[model samples]
Target: MPKVSVKVKWGKEMYPDVEVNTDDEPVVFKAQIFALTGVQPERQKVVCKGVTLRDDSWANFKLSNNALVLVMGSKEEDVPAAPVEQTRFVEDMNESELATALDLPEGLINLGNTCYMNATVQCLKTVPELKNALLGYDPSSGGGTAGGLTSALSETMRALESGGAGACAAAAARLLNALHAAAPRLAERGAGGQLAQQDASECWTEIVRALRMRLTVAPEPNSKSLIEQYFGGTLDVELVCSEADEPPTRSNETFLQLSCFISQDVKYLQSGLRSKMAEQITKMSETLGRDAVYTKTSKISRLPAYLTVQFVRFYYKEKESINAKILKDVKFPLELDVYELCSPELQERLTPMRNKFKELEDASVEKSLNAKNKSHGDSKKENKKRSIVPYWFENDVGSNNSGYYRLQAVLTHRGRSSSSGHYVAWVARGDAWLRCDDDTVSPVTEEEVLKLSGGGDWHCAYLLLYGPKILEVPEEEEEPMVTDVTEGPAGNPPTALA
Candidate 1:
């Protein structure tokens, strides 16, 4: 029995004038078709004039005694159109299926199912061996195209021959062999296969182009452009840190710590300069009277340097009660002018200090002028006047035991008092010095002495006295006063006799 079968229709029109014979026994005929056609003759039925016709239907016909035949119609004109005989071979075989039918592996079918069998066959036909096989012509025999069965047989032979050698190899090896066998042939004539290859290559090219573009494009800079573009930037000043001579790490924390350490060191230096200045001022104070104003200029102009000097103006204020004794309890305004005389070297060193002082003085003068103008424009009557006096004490009086002395002075503002008595007393105890004549000395008057001991402003006759020491006097029954004396000629006191 054949492994495959096909059914073909035969009718009156196919042999209209042929004789019929049905006397002999019919011979059963069987045929094989391509396995892909799926045709079977045994399963088919033929109808004639709305009646089913079997082999027995022609049993009574007679012509030649040994021949057997059947008529499909009574007359030729009554015959139906010749039954169409469609060849079932190669109807639905895809390239892979076709390859398999010829005993070839799936991988060898390069055109896949994307191309028609004819086109795929054409592609395969480009290869000498495959073309010879497809045309049923032996390449060695040098024959032309053969019939259908011969073509199929040739193809089967070719598939077996090409694939047989690699059957024992790994599956991948067999697949690679098949692909190599089919690729060249397909490349020449498989338009669909070639299109797919072109499309794949184009896709890969686009992907590589995209990746290259991404790599070549420049990235944006990370830092701020304003400083770089305009100022030509700089790194912040940083201190060098060492660990046994190792260079410092340039991190934010290290930089901050270094800055703090430097600031503290500066403060310490400033404090030392102040102490030294205080010490020098004390030694200078011993040589001058308490009320004598001494002036010393800065040796250096900058802060730490400028601070090392004597007689920098220091001022403070205190309130006085109405009933307080002015001679004993009143506080005085004191002023000491320290001329800042800088040595050339010191001037250069203290230039920054001088600049700062100039700035402060200008600001202060402007403020004072504005205040004065405002006060003048005010309609309210002025009852009291106030003034600020800069003053400093001799070093001996300072509590620091540095021989720094305290000096006191008065800022007296006279105003109308409603009381009958024309006097006010304001005094308090702290430090005191007297200003008299060209020379400043301690006072001799008991009242003045008491006021100095009590400490503050006092009212008294203004007398200019130039003296270096206080006069010592014993306690007496009467208050001491200078008695007026008469003068005669020759600047002599008048004689009692004459």
Candidate 2:
């Protein structure tokens, strides 16, 4: 729920105006009043006119324009405490139980209308590699200021590192500090306790930029930064015109994300990417001395381990002064295969890894069928499947294997325009999904995550982050027997011009 500002008057005294979210329960409202008047919430009953509002929630109620509300309750009341029976502290619990109790990745509080920042942080937090990289960063590692970005961001990441242990009470505060220090206008909140609605991708881009500027740890020794280490890829764009006499013009570009442009012919995400990669347009050709039709095509020169894909759904409408949405239903896959999207050389290099994935998948399917058919002997045979590839690539800078990726994190929006919408993050923690909407975090299912494909203006996927598909390698494989030809025949040498 969006935050709102309101005023409260008690008897002859007027308390300072405080901001509260209208979507929250009335108990939270009472807690706010308790801070101002030093009154216990359990003993307080808020009244508007002759009606006493229920303390459960503030539904169907408006608190706009600093509306005044009357309160009728004692300043303080003494209450008895329940008797204690059993108690278990961290000192007594094992590591697993302690971790469950702490739950390291806690939800961030929405400060006023900072949902965009909260959502962005939540989505990025899903990346354990990023968190581990941040944990390696120290404030004393580098000096000087890069737009005052490093100091604030490093501090924020430090706070986030141990969030589950309750060591940090203000993850949102640290993030807002970093954001304001880096880009003031992006973190600004206007009047009415409402912020200028921001694009989640824009915010996401800026946050990544900040981290790139600060945390310089690389996955590999010579790699640039963790941003490039995890999310960087190179694109090979080629331009060819039918009227031009010379060979096709080719160039390279770096990208952190690929935009999938929706079109009439785009029925799904793969097709949308295809439409963006290859397009025909009219351009003047110097060799032909006339405007000619040109076809521009792009392919991946390098595939990063973690891939980011943004749906090009919002565009600026100068007349409307807002980014209007396309609202098209773009279907994306849970496990994506990008083997076809790579350059010829890269595709050839990736073939071995692709074959290993196929072998594992085939073995898995066969095992499932054998179990259903009560073929335990065949199941054991299928269990002898051999792995030929490593879980990760030797050089972690590029794709691990098979050009395959699993959907990891999704950032979503819930309005028609980018400037006036709510942003949330759906993150995958192993097999479970967490839908993080500002301070309200709930468990969701994969089916619910798939429904965010943008059709009817509900929360739809705006940006997707994919991680490399990890494969287990077997210890050994069947090797052919080597025969000594010299032993077979006295005059025979091992393959001497045979």
Q: Which candidate achieves the best TM-score against the true structure?
A: 2
TM-scores for every candidate against the unseen true structure: 0.13, 0.70
Instruction: Report the Cα RMSD per candidate.
Output: 56.4, 14.1
lDDT of each: 0.23, 0.67
**Tens-digit lDDT track for model 1 on 1-498?**
112122223442232232222221111221011011112222324333344434223333223322222222232235478744444355565454344344422211211111112112222222222223233343343212212223233343355336332211122222222222333232232333221221111221222222222211012324222111111111222223221232322322100000001112222222323332222111122323233222222232111100111111111223532322222221111221112322354345334433434565686588677765666535243333322111101111100111111122221211111111121111111232222210011222223433422122323211111101111122331112211111111211111110
Off by over 4 Å in 1: 1-342, 372-498
The local distance difference test score of model 1 is 0.23
lDDT, residue 130, model 2: 68
